[model samples]
Target: MKGLRKITPYVPGEQPNYSDMIKLNTNENPYPPSPKVTEALKNFNPESLKRYSSVDNFELKKALSDKFKLSPEHFLIGNGSDEVLAFCFLAFFNSSDPLLFPEITYGFYKVWADLFHIPFKEIPLKKDFSIDLDDYRQNNGGIILANPNAPTGLFQPLEAIEKLLSENADVIVIVDEAYIDFAGKSAITLLENHPNLIIVRTLSKANSLAGLRVGYAIGNPQYIRIAESIKSSFNPYSVDLLAETLATAAIEDTDYYDKITEKICQTREWFIRELHAVGFDSLPSKTNFVLSTHPKLEISDLYQHLEEQDVFVRYFPTIERLQSYLRISIGTQKEMASVLTIIKDYLSQLR
Candidate 1:
């Protein structure tokens, strides 16, 4: 036990797989993957599994290259964005100064930093849960900003990001755009002028391929090379064959994803307004989920009641700032309507 690595692991959302439940906890796409992915899976050469997936990740990178207008060398595919971020933390954040991130952002950031023994500083978000860009002006080893940030779903504009990049040109700047498709434009456009910038994305959100576990990073070719070096040292065949085939198919079928994401956005807007009509108000979410709070109801009790009705949502009770809020993922229109009805019935019972 003495030699074992000791660190608190990141706690993921509860995943209870019940057929009849309204599962809007883990932020997965409420819809199925593209037809292209299904077709690719059906036709994928089973024998190819005997061989190791492309160590260079040529095909996956090529697919991303065509989509992002970057060459294959500028991309590095991973088992998920989590793995890609792990590699980035190891490869780039080595300076003596503390790494910087919003205190209320993704929980995994802190876990990865601690696991690697990397010094990190958690800059507090403003009272409204918006990131204070000015707080990141100090010296740091590296920077990571989760656009449309998690839990709160509030997006910081690219102009604010470019300002950070310009000031922090001495260190690496990572813009985690896992939710960017559901929000505004990506910071990938700034890569030409900022070699230190790396944009990490995942198919889990918009592409509806969360099960495939495919994610990639876009940056200057030099950074890509460095991440690839670290990846090869760790797991050369990190991405499997089936994942590559399905991920490639998902990336190419942009139209399907676009349609599904637009539907999700519409549902999120409607859900927020409906919550407001009740006594509950939610953050202006640009992601697939919203963080909401009720004036008179206990969120923990509401979460338990919803689960008893076979509806599941995320509640972060341990985090002091988030204890009163419930982070609900956007589901189908019918499913969301059911959730609303359940809440209304619950409120009526209280009266």
Candidate 2:
């Protein structure tokens, strides 16, 4: 046991294998990826697996660069945004000063900080579950925030992000925009002015490519170079050929992806309204999921009821602030209607 690393790993949502079950726990997209992704997969040469994938990630990076209007050098691709974030923590958070993040934000941030032995300070979110921008005004080695933050699904406006970048211009500030597509504009729009800003994105949610595990970070060329150096030293081929090909195809099919994202957003709003009608109130959400609770009902009891009916949503019991809430992902129209019906049945039984 000597010199062994002991740390708690991030617990991902349960992936149930039931064909009849409605799964919305992990915030994955309900729809399948673009037809382009399917065609790319079918056309990808199986013989290419004999060799290592492109070490530079040029193919995928070029696709992303062309899509985002950035040079290829501005991207650092990874197996997932989680990998990209881990690299950022290791490469940029070396200073003795503490790294900063919202205490109640993405659970992975703490995992990475702990695993890397990077000092960190988790500022508590305000009573409304909104991040207090003023809390981040202090000195820190770096900062990472999940805009349209997880579990709560509340978005921080771009103006607030700009102010954070303006105040902390000297240190690295990473905006993890994994769910930004459903929300609205990206922090990428602010990139030209803020060299210290790093924007992390994933194809898991909006692109319906969670199965492929493709994620990348956008930043100034200098930051990208530093992260790339660390990535190459750790694992030269952080992205594989199949994933690169499929993800490239998925990115190029912007129309398909955009249409699905809008549908999810619209469904999210409708679901929130329906939940309100049933005496459940949900956070104003910008992401694909909503954190909701009923004033008079037990969240645990309701969560169990939904599960018993083959409907799955997320419930975080360990976090004090979220014990009373259930985070529900927006599914297809029929699936959402089923969930609503199941919830109503539960309410009727209580009466």
Candidate 3:
């Protein structure tokens, strides 16, 4: 811990201790995983627990490869997408050149850069909060971005991403698709043409398996081998026996995944309409959350009011441009109804 001064860690969203509050700060699925996941857990053989898990996670990688229509060699699994991203930082970026990303993107990008001692530049988003792709065409060792970016819930088009890849052929371009299942488009399809492209995804969001800690990356065999080296060098058994079993089962159950996604999308649209009716404006969101701001009330005041009513939401303080807005995760219909009611009462009092 003596030389830890160089490390400034990432701060995740708040998980408050108040039991009475309706927790919606983090974008967690309101539903449980498919029954198959439970079955995998219940029927697990205790004898297998004594042995170490498969070093390469062959079974899980193959299941994902089959589901995504890619070769197993192109896949790299990790404890979570965070670990995969960390591996990317170590394997791809160097100290001589730096990484490039949106200034308001996933906070972890900055943290990973600092942790690995890799220099980086934070490109400012345009007035509409969209990335200026031209800014990234300059000098850089690698590029990383959160598709359907966090905190803002905005996404860049694949065409724009392709342009970046086309121009920056020598560097690595990492697309973090943690919320892509909700967004409907994926950059994985582009990996065949761009060997330097890497897409990182997780079972946390759409698959509703955040607790399982399953994440994977898709890229050319060579780039994936780099990640493999980093992972093997650090911890070979990163994905344990139970997690691998559950993740494979979850990936196989396509019907359950589709049904939950459909439901979440439906709820997201309704929440947007209701938010607009209450004098708030929200950006179009392809993710499981909405970012909105009201003209009359301060965001801090609204955040506190919601908490006092036993409903929790997220608020970001560092970005002054977004300090007036709140990021609300789409819960179940019943949970959202409670949030809507609280908003109605609070706004009426303001009048």
lDDT (Cα, tens digit) per residue for candidate 1, span 1-351:
578866899999877988899999989999999999999999988998887777887888888889888888999899999999999999899999999999999999999999999999999999999997999999899999899899899999889999999999999999999999886689988999999999999889888888888888999999889988999899988899899989989999889988999999999999999999999979888899999999899889999999999999998888999999999999999999999999999999988
Winner on TM-score (2 vs 3): 2
- Give the per-residue lDDT of model 3 (tens digit) for 127-158: 98878799888889899989988878888888
Cα TM-score per model: 0.99, 0.99, 0.97
User: What are the C-alpha RMSDs, in order, of all predicted structures?
Assistant: 0.9, 0.8, 1.4
The count of backbone overlaps in candidate 1 is: 0
Q: Write the per-residue lDDT of candidate 2 for residues 179-214, one digit (tens) a residue.
A: 999875699989999999999999999999898989
Q: What TM value does model 2 have? A: 0.99
Write down the lDDT of every candidate, Cα atoms only. Answer: 0.91, 0.92, 0.89
Clashing pairs in 2: none
Better of 1 and 3 by TM-score: 1
- Candidate 2 RMSD to the correct structure: 0.8
